[model samples]
Target: MRETLLLLGARRLQVPAIHVARKMGIRVVAIDPSPDAPGLALADCGYVYDLADKKQCLDIAERERVNGVMTLAADFPTPMAAFIAQQLKLPGISPRTALLSTNKRHMRAALSDANVPCPISISARSLDEAIHAMKSIGGPVIFKPAVSQGGRGITRLEPEESLNSIKSAYEHASNATRGDGILVEEFVDGPEYSVEALTWDGLTTVVAVTEKLTSGYPHYVEIGHSQPPTCSTYDVEQLSRTASSGVAALGIDWSASHSEIRLTCMGPRVMEIGARLGGGYINTHLVPLSTNVDIVGAAIEIALGRKPKIEISLKNKAAAIRFLVAKPGIIQSISGIEDVKNLTSFNDIDIFVNPGDRVLPLSDADGRLGYVICTGENSKSAIEAAETAKSLISIKTV
Candidate 1:
């Protein structure tokens, strides 16, 4: 008899994990608030309840008697996954660690105490406190919600920006967070990268490094990413070391972690760590294409208490995904998608909005109109393929 796994969240991001579990003959029961969750169709059972609702998920997990619980990419499900695992005595990261990984202040303090390099940060609750933090941390800082994701409510503060600007940004951060607080950190100037790793039995395996591209300024949103990252060997080792330290600090074991780090003149400084796979199709699409490692399958196997074989089946291949952005208006028409799909390196394209749907400015990730995933012999070729595919497509607005 196959062991049952309780999967948290049923968005398209969860589809890869569901498919992997089924391929391993593991019975999957998924939970999500969306009735039309794409992953639901692939599950042995699915419950239409908020993945963050601990009571609903626990009730279902009890009924199913699931042997394991897992979620990927989605932040809301990380703590819930830990909660369910704790309730059922399953293999997973601790609830405390999961909670720490989600909150900015808590995560920063934990990493700092562990001697991990990170930005100078302070948590502020009021406008007065934020002002004091800004003065202390100096200007050219970034403020982010204590609990938020997808770059929502992230603001950059320059020396010339008005004090009221930070005040409004403080309100934005507070509104985005479940708690009424935010962390202000001195902005590190350098290239940003993401470190993907898996931990089993207290040993961390650094999988791949991904170079991140994001919209700059007050409201930054990830636009594209490529792997393996183009960086020096020393930078890779430093990033991996910092990520491992962060994972250890968070007490993450038997789990996969996605950590963001900015390489400064000093070295790699960790921005934050997520106790799950990197989102934006990094693990599901990029990692597999770049390294020939099925991270989703490995995560599932680890959740099932199985020893997953970790190996580099391929090297030197590059994979990338570029998101489509449109002006803030009703889309009149979209063309060239069919033509772009015929490109040699085109993996897939997903258009989120239709002709009649209104496109919002690139404030948050929700503004993404579509995306293209591609793989090539090298990072340059992969990025070129994605860019070419993007250039061919057109979203007209009026």
Candidate 2:
């Protein structure tokens, strides 16, 4: 008998997982707030319900008698999905671990308790506390909602920034949080990387080391990623070890994990961790394109309590994704899309806005115009190809 798998999100990022589940002969039950979510049409059955409503999703899971529950590219659904899995005795992380992973403060505490190497962090619910936390750190720092996603409400501050700036950053984080409090932490300066891995019980197997490029300060929203970053073999090994330790510290079991690491002057320190596969199409495209490992499918297997096949079918290949951005204005025209598609290295390109549409300032990931994915013989070439693809596409705005 085919098992029913409950997907806690129906957004574009979760669509690939839905497709993978259906291909594995699993029944997909997707839930989302929007009736027109792209993944809804692909699922065997989809419910129009808020994923944050744990009781409602639990009811649906019970009604469907789902054998597994999971989510990707989202944090809101982590706790609920884990709670449902715990209630149903399905294979997944514990509800406590889910809370620890979703809330940045709790996660920092857990990592600290486990002696995992990470930056000093503090939770601040009010502006006064935030100011104090910054002073305590006594240097450059980061302010963000404890439960933020898509890089929303995250700001970096220099040590010399004024009180007004701190207050504004506090308000930004507080408003974006909606519920979770604010967190202030020492800003580690170094190259950033995300380790994509699968776990069974307490063991973690790394599949990809993704090098992250971001829009430099006040906001560090990701701009691009290259799988198997152009680093020495030792650097990759260190990143994998640090990220693996973070997964263990978070008590994540029977799931896919994406752990962000910073190679600091002292050593490799974990920045954050997720109890699901990565977002920004990293799992859906870049991972598979580079290593031939279907991470989304592996995530499904883990959700089903099966030992996922994590072996890399290919090696020495690489993939990259670069976001498209434009100056804030009304777009007049877009060019080079056809040219981008014709490129030998081109894998895919998606443009969100058209002529006469407004392109807002890039505050976070949501503000991105679109993205281009490309392949290469190695990470360097892959990144260069992605850059070339971005340059070819011109967005003229007024």
The candidate maximizing TM-score is: 2
Which pairs of residues collide in model 2?
Answer: none
Error of 2 at 350 (Å): 0.9
**lDDT (tens digit, per residue) of candidate 2 on 1-398:** 99999999898889998888878999999999999899998899989998878789999999999999999767879998899999999999999999888888889999999989988899998888998899999999999998878889989988789889988999888888846699998999889899999998878999999999999798888999998788788999999988888899899977898998889888888878999988988999999999999889988888888888777955647999999999999999999999999999999999988899998889899988889999999888999999999999999989
Task: Give the per-residue lDDT of model 1 (tens digit) for 212-331.
Answer: 888888787889999878888888888998899899999998799999999999888888899999889899989988988888888887887777898875554799899999878999
lDDT of 1: 0.88
- Candidate 2 TM-score to native: 0.98
RMSD of candidate 2 to true structure, Å: 1.1
Q: What is residue 216's positional error in candidate 1, in angstroms?
A: 1.2
Off by over 4 Å in 1: none
Name the Cα RMSD for model 1.
1.3
Clashes of each: 0, 0
**CA displacement after TM-score superposition, residue 194 of candidate 2 (Å):** 0.1
Cα RMSD (Å) per model?
Answer: 1.3, 1.1
